[model samples]
Target: MMQYRVEFVTLCALMVLAAGAWGFVALVQFAHAAEPHGFDQRILLLFRDPANLSQTIGPAWVHEAVRDFTSLGSVTVLITVILIAMLFMLFSRRPGGALFLLVAVVGGQLLNSWLKVLIDRPRPELVPHAAEVFTLSFPSGHAMLAAVTYLTVGALCARVVHGRMLKAYVMSVAVVLTVLIGISRLYLGVHWPSDVLAGWCAGSAWAVLCWLLARAVLSRRRAGEGLAESA
Candidate 1:
């Protein structure tokens, strides 16, 4: 009981920290004053070759690695993750867990789309894009989705997992993957630093919010069942 309580408190603290950080990021984005194209150019340029903007500042193999990480945030990849996680939940006879991620992920995507339109920020042209992009770049869809998918799924799995070390391992992988995908966007010159940062903030906040909601739903369901048994 104490362990569960500790874990719950830890998750709560993380969610609050993530929310506060995201708000700060949004404030910075808002205060950029005219959305200057060069707001983060100096750092961005460091990722690309100075003379050849189309190429990344690394060996050929490094580009391949970045692409692999970026693919985790792709539409097909995200969909696959959702389907697989849902299947796992259903296989385990936990439909609620499955439903939670589905709603959270799809909702996060919609929220991200709306935010992009509202911000109307363009892709970074400070350095030539090493990757193709089709959507507005205020908040990176890849970054946000990575956070939503990995963190939500990780937290759910952590609850069912038995050991503290194992749970830490799971959530750590999720955070690392989220961070990598975000960095890949910058390395590929496809998103501004601000875009990736905002995405991380928004995504983490949304995932934590959904997790808490799921817990509430589960608690109420259990309570209702308990009352029926007592009756």
Candidate 2:
């Protein structure tokens, strides 16, 4: 009984910390000035600058590599979702955590889409785009999805796993992957730097909110189970 209480309190504390951090990130994004950063142009300069890379590897190869990787976008997301589901199924001990991730990822995607429509910012027009896309460019879908999906899964994995070292490794990998994917968007010229920044902020907020709700539900479940056992 006492152990459960401790666990409940710990989860609550984590939820609060996550929410507060993400909230701050959102505010920073909101405060960004309207003056253009020309982030796309800068990245293009990086790609084209002989001192950078394309000179060594050739522009055609660089373009091919970027396009090939970016084209796997849908596949990457689908694989992540499938892996999470498989892990949850194998454990079958706690379904609440999995469901929490589900709500967070899906809800985050929807919120990002709505915000894009609301803001209606245009993508960079500096270079001929590698691929055809028709979405507004406020909060990047890739960035948001990366945050919600990877971090939520990381949290859930931490909860289920027993070892501290293993949990640390998994969570670290998750965070790095999410950050890299967001960076890839900027490098690919598909999204603005600010768009990715806002996506990270909003998506993190949603993930934390879902975590809080999930913790509350788990506590209630534990309490009810205790009552039933006593009766």
Candidate 3:
């Protein structure tokens, strides 16, 4: 009964992931054509003053806060965390898991870069940016990276770790980090709202794919080991 229940839950999760993957594809198509669309311009205006253009919508302090929050998604910080976590997983005798994480996060980074280059969308010019940016804008890199890194690590750890409460806590932190990072991109005027939204969609789907791959690899390994022992 317990095994059946777990399988049922896994099936449901896979269904949700499938739906999300479709939604992400649709969003990418939608956002791709949003360049000349008026709605993109209108939404970006909401975060900044149209009249002054140089001014952002929020209080001065909020800008500073957002800058700090946005930095959590920065490559320097995310990569450092990934390295430490991967090392820990490897040393703990979970080399497959570690390899999965390393591939997932780093591959996500490469995908993000490729998407940005392919889309070739410019940074939001509707308002003066509150943060410095050197990359092409569509699908905010910060937002995507945050989601890819946090969720990949969180979900994988939760799968192996012992407690339901701990799993929930890990996933929650991952979600909060993803949300905050995405929002900070908007608040700082570095990315259009659409860019961030599309980013969330894509990054999440990628993380889910990575999670499934890791789970399958580990499961297969365990099954093979058990068969060998029985033989």
How does each model score on lDDT?
0.84, 0.67, 0.82
Best-performing candidate as measured by lDDT: 1
Candidate 2 per-residue lDDT over residues 1-231, each given as its tens digit: 988977886676577557745654554443254645655456554544355432323467766666654543443654577466646745886655556666777787788788788776787654445466678777777777777777788887787788879999888977777677776666666676677777777767777777777867877989999999999
Q: Please say which candidate is ahead in lDDT: 1 or 3.
A: 1
Instruction: Please give the lDDT score at residue 36 for candidate 1.
Output: 49
lDDT of 1 at 117: 89
> In model 2, where do residues sit more than 4 Å from their true spots?
1-35, 38-76, 83-87, 90-93
Mark the regions of model 3 whose C-alpha exceeds 4 Å error after superposition: 34-39
How well does model 3 score by local distance difference test? 0.82
Per-candidate TM equals 0.90, 0.74, 0.89
Shift of residue 107 alpha carbon in model 1, Å: 0.5
- Predicted candidate 3 versus true structure: per-residue lDDT over 1-231, tens digit per residue: 998986886686687577756766666664577453576677777777767777877789887888899999999999898998888788888887788888998899999999899888888777778888999987889988898999988876886788889999999999999999998887777888778877887788788777777778778989999999999
Residue 184 error, candidate 2, Å: 0.8
Q: Model 1: per-residue lDDT, tens digit, 1-231?
A: 987995887687576657746673664554255754465677688888888888798899999999999999898998998899899999999988899989999998999898888878878777777788999987889998999999988987897898989999999999999999999999999988778888888888888778777777887998999999999
- Candidate ordering by lDDT (highest first): 1, 3, 2
Ranking of candidates on TM-score, top first:
1, 3, 2
